[model samples]
Target chain A: MRVTPAVELDDVSFGYRPGQRVLEGVTLRLGEGEFVAVAGPNGGGKTTLVRLILGLERPGDGRALLFGEPAHRFSQRRTLGYLAQRFELGGDAPATVREVVSAGRLAAGGLIGPMRRRDRELVAEAIERVGLSERADAPLRTLSGGQQQRAFIAKALAGEPSLLVLDEPTTGVDAETQESLAALLDRLHSELGVTIVYVSHEFGAVERFVQRLVLVRRTIVFDGSPQELPGIWHDPSHVHA
Target chain B: MLESEFMRLALGAGIVIGVLAPAVGFFLVQRRQSLIGDGIGHVAFAGVAAGILLDVSPVLTALVAAVLGGVVIEVLRSRGGTAGDQALALVFYTGIALGVVLISTAGALNVDLFQYLFGSILTVTRTDLVVIAALGAVGLATVGLLYRALAAVVVDEEGARVAGVPIGGLNIAVAALAAVTVALSMRVVGILLVAALMVLPVSAAGRMAWSMRSTFVLAMAIGLGSSLVGLTISYYADLPPGGTIVLAAAVVFGTAVVVSAARGR
Candidate 1:
C-alpha cells in the first residue's frame, strides 16, 4: 500500500467564464517535501493551478485533494503560506514591518485575545530569517519593493506553514536580492523540510534550486527533474550548456 | 441651552450618527467602496421623496430603497461585468433626479424637501430618534459579529475566499449594512453628506491607528467629539448643525494629513 501525496488534482478542469476552458484534464501530484517549480509560457495556467492548489478557485470538473482529503475540506489553512503576485499592502495602512509580519499568524488563529509573547518571538524569528531584523520596526511604505516583498514573505513564514506557494516571488526584485531569496527558499526546503511550489517564467534562474520541474503549457506537458526537462522542452540538436 | 425639546432630540441624533457613520464608513474606506455609500444615499433620498408624496413616513421608504439599491449594486457588480460602474452611476443620478422631480411636483404635502436634503434638527421627532437608536444598535452589532470575516475580506478578498470566508455572502452583508447606515444617517446628516460622515472620521483615524479595532474605536471617539462640538457651535452660532459636523470632521482630516506629512509619512 502506498501513501497518497500531499496534493493531488484528478482530471481537474476550469474556466473563467461559461464555456472557455483554460485548463482541462490537468492532473498533478506533489509529495510532502517536494520542491516543485511550475514553469510555463506567459498565458499558461501556472498561476491558475497555484490558485486551485490554494483552494482559491474551484475546479469546474473533477476532484482536488490535499492530504488525501478534498482540498476544500482541509480547514487548516495556516498550514500553507501563499504569496500572490500582486498582493497589495496599502500605502496608508498603518502597520510596521513587524506588525505586517504578524498578520501571517492570523491564519493560524494565533490572534488569541491579543499579541502574545510567543507570537512576538515568532514574528522576530520570521523577520530575522528573512534577513530583515534591522527593518522590522520600519513602516512598510518606507521599504524598497524588494524589502516589501520580503516582508510579505516573512508574514507568510510567521505561520510556520508546511507548504510555501509563491507566484513570481522574484518578478521585480533585483538580481542580488533574487539570489538571496532563492538561497533562503532553498534553505527552507533543505533544512526546514518545507514543501515549496513556486510559479516562475524564468526557468534558467530557478533551475538549480528546484528538485522537480512541472512544465505547464495550459496543461501538464512534462513533470520531471530540471535536467530531464531540457530534452522534453528544448530542441535536442541545439542544446547548449 | 438644551432646554428646548427639539434641540435635545437634534443633539441626541447628532451624537448617535457620529458613532454610526464612522463605524460603517471605515469598512467602506477599506474596501474602496466609499462611492457605493454615496449611491445608497441618493437612492434613500428617492425613498424619502416617495414617503412625502404618499403621506407615509419617509424613513421607512428610505430604508427600503437604500437596502434595495445596495443589493442592486452588488448584483450589478457581480453580474454586469463591464457595465457595473455605469449602472451604479445611473442608479445614483436617476435616484437623485427622480427625487427632485417627485419632491417638486408633489403638490399635496407642502413639506419643504430641502429640509431633509440638508438635515433639520428641529424636524427630528422622538419617533425618528427611536428609529435611529434601534437601527444604530443593529448596525453596530452586525459589524461586531462579523468583524473577523469583514477584516479578512477587506484585507484580501481572494485570500479570504481561499480560506473559506464566503466572499459573495460577506460582500452582500457589507452592502446591506451600508444601506442601513445610509438610511439611518439620512435623517440626521442629510443624504448629501452621508458619505462624508462615513469616510472623514475613519480616514482621519487611519492616519494614526495600526489595528482595525483601534481604528474603529478612534473613529468613534473622533466622530463623537466632532458631533458634540459641532452641535454646540451650531446652537451658539445659529448655523446648520450637519454642516458644522462635516466641517469639524474636515478639520480633523486636515490636521491628520498635516501631522502625517510633518512626520515624513
Candidate 2:
C-alpha cells in the first residue's frame, strides 16, 4: 500500500509581487521518511520553496499539498517542526536552552496551562538527543554558535514532529560543527523515520546524508540522488546564475 | 503613614502596579521594544489633556488614547521594514505636540501638568484605585493566559508563526497590555515610573535569570519591591513618588549592571 506523499508541489508558482516570480512552475513530491537537500545560490528561491511547503506562503497557481491537504490550510501545527535561517535565531533572546527547546511543545501543547508531564519529558529527551543535556539550563547567549544551533534543533525536536524542515541550519558554524550537525540529523532521521527537508546554500554538509538533492534557481534545475549532483552546482561562481 | 486613608489608597495602587508592569514589560524588554511603554505614556498625556477639557476622568480617556497609540505602534512595527522605528518616533513626537496644544487650550482652567507628569497622592481617589485594580487584573490575566505563545513570538516571530502561534493577535495583546499598564500607572506613579517600571525591573532581572519564567517572576518581584519601597519612602520624606519609585528601580538596575559586568558578561 502506498502512503500519502509527505509534501507535494504541483505546478505551483509564487511571487512577492505580480510578474516578479520568486518561484514558478515547481512540481515536486517528497515521500514519507525521505531526507532531501534543497540547494541554491543567494536569492535562488530555495527558501521560498520550503516556505511554500511549510505553509508559510501560498502558490499563485496550482496546489501545494501537505499529506494530501492544501498546504496553506494544513492545521496540524504540531506535526511540522521548523528551524529558520541562522541570523533569525539571534542569541540575545533571554531564554535558556531548555526554555527555548520547551517552546517546541507550544504547538503541541496549547499556549495556556501548565506543560503536561509528557511535554516536560519530551523536552528533556530532545535536549539529550542534541547532546546538550549538560548545558540544558544555560542561557542561549553563553553557548557557541553550533551549540546554539543544536539548542534550536532540540527545540524543533521537542514537538515530536512528523516532518522537520531546517533552513540554513549550518550557517555560521565551522566545518567540524557542520559535520557533527549533519551526523546528528542523519541519526535523528534514521531513528525517528520523519520526513526531513533541509534547505541550504551549502548542501555539501548534508550531501552524503540526504536521499535526494534538488537545486533551485527560481525553479527546479536538478532533482536526483546525491551521486548525480551536477558539475555546475560544484562551482560557486556558477551558483550566482 | 499607615493611618491615613490616602496612604491606604496609594499602597493599594502600588500593589496593583507592582503586579501589572513587569508582567507585560517582560515581553517588551525581551523584544527590544523597551521604549514602547514610554511612547504610550506620551500619547496618554494628550488623552489626559483631552479628558480635562471635556470634564471626563483622565484615566479613561488616557486608556483609550494609549491603547490606540499602542496598536498603531504595533501595526507600524509589524510591517517590518526600515520605516518602522522611524514611524514610531514620529508618533511619539506628535503625541506630545498634541498634548501641549490641548493643555494650552485648557490653560484658562486649573490644569496642572505637574499633577500627571509626577503623580499626586491627593488626586488618587478610591474610585481611581478601583479602576486601576480592575484593569490591571485584566492585563495580568491576558499575560497569564497566553504566556507560552507570547514567549514563542517574542523569542522568534517567524518560528512562532510557523508553529501556528497567532502573531498578530499576540502582538496586539502585548501592545494593549502595555497601554493598560501605562494608563493605570500614570494615575498611581505618574508617567515617569509608568515606563521605567516596565523596562528597568526586567533589565535587572535579565542579569540573573537563566530561564524565561525565572526572569519574568523575578522582574515582577523587583517591580513589586520598588513600588512598595518607593511609595513608603516618598510618603515619609515628602518626595515625588514617581521619581522616587523610578530611582528605586534604577538602583536595582545599576546593581544588576555591575553584577553582569563583574561576571565578565
Candidate 3:
C-alpha cells in the first residue's frame, strides 16, 4: 500500500503580531519519496512554512498533519531530520566530530540506551557519508565552514530519517561543498527513497534533482515538475533579482 | 601544623565549593552566558548584606536573592527587549549599589566588606556546608537528567526545539542552577571570582576535549584538583584560600591555552 503525503498544511495562518497575517490561508502537501523545493523571496512565509512543518510554531487557523497524523501528536520525530536556515552550532562547544554527529541519534535514543553494534556502524557510516571520517576525532570548532555544514548533515542523517527537511543548507558553503551537498541530496532522494523538502534562494542542480517544485510567493504559485517552469514572466516586473 | 578546626572547616568548604562551582559553570559556559553568572554573584552580595543587616544567615539571604536575580535575568533575556550586556550591567550595578548601601546603613562598621568581595572559606559554617551540599546534589541531578536536552539546546536552541526539546523550560532551570551555585560559592570564591571558576575550567577543558560529556568531566577534574592543591598551598604559605584556588585555576587555564596554541588550534 502507498503511504500518504509526508506533510499536509491545510489553511494554515500565522504571524508574529495580531492583525498581521504572515501566512494567510496557506495550504500545501508533500507526497512520500518526492523531492520538493519551496522557493520564495525574503519575508514571503517560506521559513514560516518550514517552521510549521517542523512543529516550531502553531497555526492560527486550520490544521496541519504529518504522515497522516496530527502534527503535534506525531511523535515519530526520530524519523524526521531538519537543518534550519539560521544554523548555529555552539562555538566553544567541546563536541568532537564523532560526538556531534552522534547527537543526531539523540532523537533515536542512542544516548539513553546502550548502542548496539549496528548503531556504532551507523554512526561510522554517518561520519563517512559526510566525508569527514578523517576528522571524526577532531573537535567541531576545528573544522572549516563547509566541513562543519557537512557534519551537521551527518548529524541529521544519523537517525536514518525518512524525511529530510533542509532550509537553505548552502548559505555559507563554498561552490564545491554546495555541489557535493546537492549530489548527496540526489543520492538520498533517488537511491535511498528518502523524502526531501528544502527551501533555497538559488536553484542549481536542484532543478534536475527535485521531482516537484513548489514556488511559494506568500501562496501556492506553482507545484509541479521543475522543467515545466514558464519562460515568460507572469508579472511584468519579474526579474532574476 | 594541622591543629586548627577552623582550617579543617575552611578546607572542607573550599573542596565542596570547588566541585559545585565548576558543576554549574559547565552549563553556563555551554550557554555562552558565563558573564550572567557573575551578575548573579553580585546580586547575591546584596542578599548577603541583607542577611548581615537582619542578623540572619548570609547564605540563606544570598540564596533567595540569587534565585530571584537569576529569574529576573532570565525573564529579560527571554523578553528580547534589552541587550544581554545592558541587562547584565543593570543587574550588576543595582546589586553592588544595594549591597553597599545596606551594609553602610546597617552600622556594622566592623564588618569587613573585603571578606565578601574577596571571599574567605574560613568563614564557612556547618550550616553553610549543609546548604551547599544540598544545592550541589540537586544541581548535579538536574544536570544529569537534563544533559541530553541541555546539550541539544545549548548547541542549537531553535534546532533543538524543532527536534522536540523543551528549550524555554530547560533554559530557566539552568538559570536556577547557576543561581544556586552563585549563592553557595559566594563564601568560597566571592562574587567577583565565582564566574571565573565557571568559565576558566570549562574553557580550558573545551580546548582539549571534543564532547560535552568529556568536557564536563575534564572541567570537574581540573576544578577539584586545583581547589585542593590551592587550599594546601594557602595553608602552608599563609595566603588567602580563595586567591590561591583562583591562582591554581589560572595556572591550569594558562597551561591549556599554551597547549592548544602549540598544538595548532
DockQ of 1: 0.27
Q: Which candidate number has the best DockQ?
A: 2
Looking at model 1 chain A, report the run of 10 residues with the lowest lDDT sum. Answer: A232-241
The best candidate in terms of TM-score: 2
In order, the TM-score of chain B in each prediction is 0.95, 0.95, 0.93
A1-241 per-residue lDDT for model 1 (tens digits): 9787888999999889999888889999999998888878878888888878877778999888877777877776767788877876632445578767766766565322456678779989989988899998876767888788888888778778877888888787676667667777888788778888888765555667889989887789889988876555742322131
Task: Rank the models by DockQ, top first.
Answer: 2, 3, 1
Collision count of model 1 = 0
What is each predicted model's overall lDDT from 0 to 1?
0.79, 0.85, 0.78
Q: After superposition, how far is residue A239 of candidate 3 from its true place, in Å?
A: 20
What ranking emerges by lDDT with the best candidate at the front? 2, 1, 3
Q: Where in model 1 is the C-alpha error above 4 Å?
A: A11-21, A58-63, A69-80, A98-138, A157-162, A190-192, A203-206, A229-241, B78-80, B97-111, B208-215
**DockQ for all candidate structures vs. native:** 0.27, 0.52, 0.42
Q: Write the per-residue lDDT of candidate 2 for residues A1-241, one digit (tens) a residue.
A: 8779999999999999988999989999999999999988989998899899988899998899998889889977678889988534332446888888887888887788678899999999999999999999988888999899988888888888888999988888787888788889999999999899999898767787889999899999999997887665663522222
Chain A TM-scores, candidates in order: 0.91, 0.94, 0.89
**Model 2 chain A weakest lDDT span, ten residues long:** A232-241
lDDT digits (tens) for residues B35-140 of candidate 3: 8898898899899889889999777888999999998888777766558657867988899899888887887545477677778787777877777777788877
CAPRI grade, predicted model 2? medium
